[model samples]
Target: MAWFRNLSRFSTINVSRRHDPFLLSSFNCFSSNNINTNPTIEKPSVDPVQYSGLGPTKPHEKPRVVVLGSGWAGCRLMKGLDPEIYDIVCVSPRNHMVFTPLLASTCVGTLEFRSVAEPIARIQPAISREPGSYFFLSNCTGISADKHMVHCETVTEGEQALDPWSFTVSYDKLVIALGAQPTTFGIRGVKEHAIFLREVHHAQEIRRKLLLNLMLSDVPGISEEEKRRLLHCVVVGGGPTGVEFSGELSDFIMRDVRQRYAHVKDYVHVTLIEANEILSSFDVRLRNYATKQLTKSGVRLVRGTVKDVQDQNIILNDGSEVPYGLLVWSTGVGPSPLIHALDLPKAPGGGRIGVDEWLRVPSVQDIFSIGDCSGFVESTGRQTLPALAQVAEREGKYLAHLLNKIGKAGGGRANSGKDIDFGEPFVYKHLGSMASVGSYKALVDLRQSKETKGISLAGFISWFIWRSAYLTRVVSWRNRIYVAINWATTLVFGRDISRI
Candidate 1:
């Protein structure tokens, strides 16, 4: 037993024969003698077991690159990064990245639930093990900027509670793409009661809840008022998410749920509540078109700030109260507490980090901030970039190009570029926007000169265009196919409302 233990201990030193001559000779002496002395034996030079944890360190992998969040900015950054350049790892609780624009369609079964979600691990170049790329460390709670470390909570399989897990990763560069979280505006009961539309799980949960409400309402013992309360759905904030979700809910209720359960046709109600005018950012014609389409679809529109959100009711700032079952809060943006916690150099208006036009934090050149969390000033330095997906996407591409230049330049000169030197100082190209109303009708706001405006199409044609555009925009072919099949099947039949 002692000799066996010694032999096992000797195996641990099998790093390199040149490094540990003693153990190398002990094993090699036996093997070489057995092979060459017998002349009938052939020996292999490489053994994976010896090199399992003892292989030559491959240049320390240029330090493990940890990306926080798998949202638009994070995913785009992962996609854009050259695998040969840095060892990449994406950290987010979600395994799949939800294509938010197509998410509303998924909720209504117009697009299959699976179609709109691209697995984070499956994006192109397949970040899993492409050269210097690796994906691990999913959950991030906080970061230690001084130490250049991230504090995370992880759990084992089937574990009920999360336990603290720590890993110290030294990075040559850090990209803070944590993105923005849902803002409740200090409104009571919003966080506890309402469901947000940011992630795939949220969408799935909404679908499940809607189905459960539908089925539970049909239960024999439930009262009419209970059914009404169960059936009514109110969506707060008339931004793209809120409006589209409302439209999806309306479509599901009118087209599928009503058809399937005729008894609840009159009971189902969806209200879109916006603090300001609905889709105010869009062209007035498009806004009016969306408002009109929503109104025509039996979906009610309320304009007021949400004063308070109760479990069963919403109190508006105007002192009006509306009863509801489901509440979807999509009011506005706030800095992700993750970013806010950094307590770094902040600009005006609530600690928002003001970055230069090139998207680098003024304090730290290596730390680049983009997306909603960053307030990047335009060339005139008068207005800031709007917190839109298009803006984030453009910023991401700009950063990628800049990083590519950095890679091309190499060495000390890589870090010496002015904010405005990147051609234009983040000129936002308005590529137009689109929002669905219900069932078939949608308003496409083509604000670009190259594109036309007020393209309203209803029924199958609009639906087809919507699906095609979104599917093309989905991260990868795998997701596109998954979503396409899901949409096709749902179109032919219906949603599988059964919960797991």
Candidate 2:
């Protein structure tokens, strides 16, 4: 994390560079209570109407655009926008945008840990390298609609303390793209027991725990039963994330754990419990293929829901219990604390902030929301979009174009929802889904494309596609090489099991 802290030194914070740096142990999610009500910040003096392209503007004038979170949506908007014209400020807890697909690989050591995380500061050299554009890592507490300011808190660990931890980020055009968090679904003990797979720290923690379990199994005082229990890994939720993590875990056990602890090879077990069929989101045929592939790779598939997660054991809905050393929770995402804290119009069930075609939060015209944090209401039957990286990425690109059009047109404040329509409605294309099973096999469900014409592929070919796609999908050149090298190393030497 030294490099991570170092990346922010070049950003436009006016604070002194003398203080010690530390990664906030896990993410510090700031609720309204944790944030100070008032903080000192630079408010924009330029006329909003002229800066927003509604009125005439001088050559030197710039709009204050504040984007929350450095996930796909926030980063994409920053990358595409001309930072020189707009004074951009990014606020988030994490300093990097994790490549989620390769996160599973990092857990089992197929890829290096650093390969999956690209520093947020490097996302856009144009803005990140600018004199005043800042990509600050802080917790977004609340939005003051009356004052047009975002309340933020910077919480850090270790001995050295930072000055003025709480502050305000004022924006002329605001973007609330703070992404979602792992949902326990109100299940008992899940937060207390299970490990989430949402961020880089989660993957690092998984690796640490897995290595510890392996080493503990080899201890002399441990009985065979204890060792067997130590090898029981349970994965909840059968989505692509869960399936991909399960596959990587199986590969780790079969290749590394088995060879290292041959005596307990038969005892090592990986169980995947899903309320519905595994890979239910995929086409039926692709789902079947995934099931077959997972079964062949020695992963136990359980068709049930997890009622409760107790220490060392998970109680299923049917009263069955499965003991586990590692419980990786891959259940679907829910609204983040920031999202829940918002007082805005939401869907009937009340999960995400409801956004119209222009991705504007209701009642707040200048404020826009995107990514998993915002629940999109599509034109077609009011269908809610899934919380995927692809969806967030697409939404980011569209918002950039929307804002740029308004800026070019010299628009001002929206009088009503009808006034904000600068271009065509936002459209989300179904790109397709893919999951990797162990032993060089994968399942891919592609929508109608020029090449595939809507095809479902499985086995080695799909696996190859999976690797190639993710290899190129890495956001940075350094990360891409790191992943490629890690993959090559994994192929020749197997996954690294060292805990530290």
Candidate 3:
């Protein structure tokens, strides 16, 4: 019995060592003479010391390039950067980059959520494998341009017991690609009531709420008025996101809801409220076609401004009440609160961080800004580019090449790139625009601008082109296959309505 008890104690110590690697080393440090003979002896427990953060790189180490966000701009830059020349460190609240174009499809079961998300590790493998490169799941709180450091706090969302902790990272070059936030225009209850279709979680919430409303409206003893309000879907904004989502919702109703929830099929409806013309950026003809297409698909297009949002309905500027179970706000984006807090030079109109032709922040050394967070300085006499994904992506690609050139020229260090020639300035040429409006229909405008005359197509042919273009543009082949499979599955099996 004594030998068995000793063996049990040894096994318990071995299990503790397996759980905590440091326990084995600490146990080994105790000599036999120092070992406690009393089996009931207890030692005081001390909490483990928390890590501070990464310090400034030494002269012998590779210069660190710290990126702030994982959106289209930041992800593109990371993908194009040369890992051999510099160590990359990405800090963002989320670990994945969302494909915003197809995000609307995910809300209505046209495509699965995972198909529209690409992990940051897959985008830049060096961050996970390289000795110095890293990807921190945190949000940048502040930037110290003079000291070349950024203050960040970890994102501990959904883990109620674990409080977020702060850390600092020193960088040789800092790229600010922090994306913009959805603009609410200071409307009452916009933030609390209306859901913005930006992140993966937002789409998931929309799907869950939509499914729940559908199921609840069909329950017995529910009044007709209640069922109508519960099944009515409201979308505010005339942009591509709002229009595409309305289209997708209508498609789901016509195909899935009518067949699955036959009891309340007549109650399901989609209403799109836009103050101005839909697809305003497209050609006049394309906008007209989109309008006709949406009208034909049983979508009620209302031209009214939203005055207030309530729990179960919205008040329009004309004193009319529009009741809905689901309200999605996509009224475009503006600079985030961090951008407003930063004491940097801003552009003329949009309040974005001001950058020179080389995408470098004007008065800051070893710092650059791209994507929706950056704009050309007023002194440059250049118009601020429109906030579009294509613009951000191209800017990211250009900056990546520029940074690679600087690194090769021995300028990839703090305040060492002053003498390097930053070649020709970045020039953005408008690429084209495309939007899908359900029922196997779409619009494609290849014109450089609304003023320029280029090839513009509408109907089924453009729809094919739209799908083909985005399919090839998906970040990875893995996600491309996932999206393709999801689409095929949806077409054959109809959307997987197992609301797990």
Candidate 4:
């Protein structure tokens, strides 16, 4: 009766006078003589639709911090941020942070994929629980610094058949930690044929391909040359990732493959192709030790430049061809296409997004950058920091503290932190390096630089130290436990060779 009385009042007041099509249609819907029964939706009028996005924050709401990545830098920043001071919004293609140092272990089944991946929610609970905080499974397409907004599009690249939609988010502060992509030196077919070891999925692909090659090589009618080619795994980088993967592959061939896939074990081989010396960042002695250990583990080390990459083989600069079943490209990382497209200033030498000593983008109001995507501007007279996980992690930690300090000073709003005294500039101190070279052998260099004299260790003791250090570095307790269990299982039962 109440609903009918209200409708009668509205109908009585304007039913006769109103000529609006929408209002007339509404009245017709309730007409007793000609009631509409169809539930099908009508098409909308032709008008340019506005993109839906998070608008500027109200005065009463907490300041929003938009982080444009989920790597070591962004995740660390989100973890340390004071959620009560600012709402967190993370935009990344992947929802988890890959423990990169241990990523190679996953490729050879020394560790499970899940063990190296810590979900974004697990790293920062506020993003999942807080009313204003959120995690977006998307890639940032562009940034509008003047408007304090970031443009992002959903990532629906896999099995899902949904179309990607674009959205924008306004932020009081924006942190760019998009990281970097693997360098291929403009070689042809590299992107189409070779896989890079930067993410968990990459490692998974390597594992799947390795197993597939092994099984295929064991086929009854295959020729000897074809079998050898199919079982040959070539790694194109001498850095930590490539070396470690080579070590893991050799270990797998010697231990697990020899016993389980005995028919193809003799044919399985690993070749590490490096343009220069492997582990060039470590001390000379340590590098020598790594080289020797890798060789002793049955990995063939090749010093040559890749001229071109083909589907089944690579052509060297010297007109030689190296056939391989699997190719991994880890020649180090450089700025991504998004970085190049950005109109912001870039650091010299590598074209990374430029930042001041305080990690703030100069001339920009509230934008900052870190991780492999950022570097110091030339004016700062500071050399760009190496693109290492520790460098990114520490930079993120420092920026979090700095932002929290600004928030406490009542400058958490966009364009309001101009006069705040940012206490200290970010100074990077090299914390040493560690790498595992199979057969219970490793290298640990504690020097601040190649010239600096400090503790450097090699052998099984170093391997033990490497394991203990990275085990503690795994993002969450759950993953740490997973990694430890995986390692133990591997040591007891050997590396898992299941293709799936």
Candidate 5:
């Protein structure tokens, strides 16, 4: 239908597809296709390798590994590790991994939502193959560390009332990958009024709100004041998420929205507010460049902390108010409720769950934490690594390698109960950061060391690099093709303003 509306017009690259693993992979969690009535499912044929104390990691007898939250960290670890080694169980409310870096693109019609989302089953086939492995669509509510059990609640609707909706699954090794959520910082009404940018649903909600405002602006007999309010979009928190959304919104307004709603084009506006500075996490050069680029692209940058957010307006520290049709809260991430609920040590100031360099909870063995949920402790006195997808992915791969080494070394055994020796602590290598500010303009901040300054690149070249980098990072070829086609058609025909 409309998916290929103008696809024939552009000479598109044909992406070769990667087939899903043929092995009856255990796709637990929230799959409509593959659901195990029993949490303890049949195991796939084992790798024939032998083990002591714990015995060989068979589907039934292998050390049961439970991974919480299928974000970047959990997903990668599930993919990198051998199903032949550990019986893996993954639990999360969602079954899809939202390629977060390109999420803003989806909000403004630069890319379709499905293209950027990869189902966990497709990425982590090993999890599906593991016997007794459960793909649970649920939230981990409590962890009985003493008993090595995780208390979870099934969130799926339409289940039998008499059926067990909540249960505890015992784990030999537990992984905490429950990523962070939006922090309103106790600002009044923010929790209810402002939209967050943490998940796929957040992006969907933003898209709906954005289009709704546009439609409302076109309604007859609407007052100028109401129209102004309907068209005014405010983005809070000038981090990568906020800046990118503002940029994308700016692009939508200039490239598509303005042309489509020519009668009231000038009334539509975007304002981005930050407590300190936009892209404060980036190098100074890149941050400055982003500020200038966003301003040049007609996104008003307000350097002020938000004190309170009302349904109709945002209140600033200086007591000024800015009316808005849509308010997006992209403020820094905070620990999730599940993290706080655990009786675990938290990092200072940020309240993130603390983990040793091996990504293990120092006080609790067998339970490891990673990604945004866990703060890496450095013996070198370095700051905890930034909560980034790259960092999470790297940690996952490292953890997988460690698990492989441990499985071979017989570290994960029930009878012996020996501590696994992860010889080296995690060392993070900062690659670079990039943010697009509309109109094919972007900024890139390459890594820097104490001895030398890093390289900084901006403008059209960086934008191309941004596109190429994210394109290559997408997991599946089918999704890559879909995203490529969406981008091509958008450039050629502009965004289709279909609200539904």
Candidate 6:
């Protein structure tokens, strides 16, 4: 009855009675069945050839190339890639590419986490047919090299936490730029207790966990020893990440917590334990500078190997136990599971994939590997390029050039001369190393021959250089501005203690 009533609204009201005779005549003829039954065949419409939105590019256009990972290598490759030639697609688990150098700063509240993260979908050669063309395959599990498809499991935007959260994508040419992760070395308790500083999410989790520990230490019923343990932040590995985190943690204690929780200031401490002397990778001069600054900042530097990480303490190789509230492990990297799954040939010492000068896989000519995961040999010597943003960036650009060339040739010829041509063996020009020590001191290793030539920085000068270089290297103008604003705000009114 409701449906009929709703349909009743379609009654045709007569506006002009002058046309009533014609209507009545037509109705009468139909009632009398005087209509001739004819089989009328109607031709369907033939629309003229019209182009849709950026319709799959011209036939002679570049081949479909897909890049995996949005880290330093993948992002840079996409950035440098030519739009006209290759139909570019970037698939990664993370939607945003984190500028990992500044990740520690974000955790310690020196910078906003968002400032260090550049959305992968935002930066591309041009606004693609698909707005999210820099496709975020957040659930990527493995690669089907045989099928030339990325076996992914991704959730649509805003539905990540829900149960239905996995999808796959097909690709033509795939670039594996997936970087390395922190290696546990089969060490027990390392995986269970030690926090890592690999991504923006890790930084965020660490920040939240650190804040929680601080707040819980201030609880009324908690004992002083427990509070002490809670406030002691022990960092393993004296590399740039560990050193920077220690420095930032020290500053946080002295600057923010001391003024607010003066009683807890004495309890708060940061200790860095390294197998060897800190910053083992850096030049001795720079390492010494960093050590001196760290010591002066009241961070205890323990020179020995860590035997094990327990519930609330780190046991050193020398039979000494140091109680810690938070244990951060920034030790070293190993081959990612994805890379290892490929069963590619690896170097002896490190398990990084082996390649010749052009950056291609030894067996798989079309597939290219770069960043921390790739290992290339030179005519002069063998060197595994350290997993750094700089290295990844260069390799990515180089890969883009090779890919462009391959597309131009219409996939007729091999891009490089060697079976695994990793582009002239990727000689990493040591552009010096820098460590941010507490206060206004930062140790700068000026290995470069330019204006900053071999100068060690201390006080405000080193700090300025460190800030400027990192800010310059940050991905986008919007992100750089946000970081600058956060820095200015922190200087003016101190860090906001809000957590979400």
Range of the 10 consecutive residues with the lowest summed lDDT in candidate 2? 48-57
TM-score-sorted candidate list, best first: 4, 3, 5, 2, 6, 1
- Candidate 1 structure quality by residue, lDDT tens digits, 295-336: 888899987888888889888888988888777778878787
Enumerate clash totals for all models, in the order shown: 1, 5, 0, 0, 8, 12
TM-score of 2: 0.85
Q: In model 3, state the lDDT of residue 93.
A: 87
Q: Model 3: per-residue lDDT, tens digit, 1-500?
A: 21112112221121112334443334423323234555444442322343235678788888899999999999999999999999998999888999999999999888999999999989999987787788888889999898899988767656442355555788999999998999999999999989999999999999999999999998999999999999999999989999999988889999899999999999998999999999999999999999999999999999999999999999999999999999999999999999989988898886899999989999889989999999999889998898899999999999999999999999998889999999999999998999999988999999998888999999999999999999999999999999999889998988866676
Model 6 worst lDDT run, 10 consecutive residues: 8-17
lDDT of 4 by residue, 1-500 (tens): 21122233221121211223443445445434444576463322222233445778889889999999999999999999999999998889898999999999899899999998999989999987787787887889999998999987767665843455556789999999999999988999999999999998899999999999988988899999999999999999999989888988888889899999988778988999998999998989989998998888899999999999999999999999999999999899999999999999999989999999999999888999999999999999999999999999999999999999999999999999989999879999999999988998889999998888999999999999999999888888998889888989999988888888
Q: Which scores higher on lDDT, 1 or 2?
A: 2
Model 3: pairs clashing at backbone N, Cα or C within 3 Å: none
Candidate 2 vs 3: which has more lDDT:
3
Output the worst ten-in-a-row residue range by lDDT, candidate 5: 1-10
Model 2, range 115-146, lDDT digits (tens) per residue? Answer: 98988768877555565466666788888766
TM-score of 4: 0.92
Query: Would you list the C-alpha lDDT of every candidate in the order shown?
Result: 0.66, 0.75, 0.87, 0.87, 0.77, 0.70
RMSD (Cα, Å) for all candidates, in order, is: 9.4, 7.8, 7.4, 8.0, 10.7, 13.4
- Which is the winner by TM-score between candidate 1 and candidate 4? 4
Which numbered prediction scores highest in TM-score against the true structure?
Answer: 4
**Residue 204 miss distance in model 5 (angstroms):** 0.9
Q: Cα deviation of 468 in candidate 5 (Å)? A: 0.4
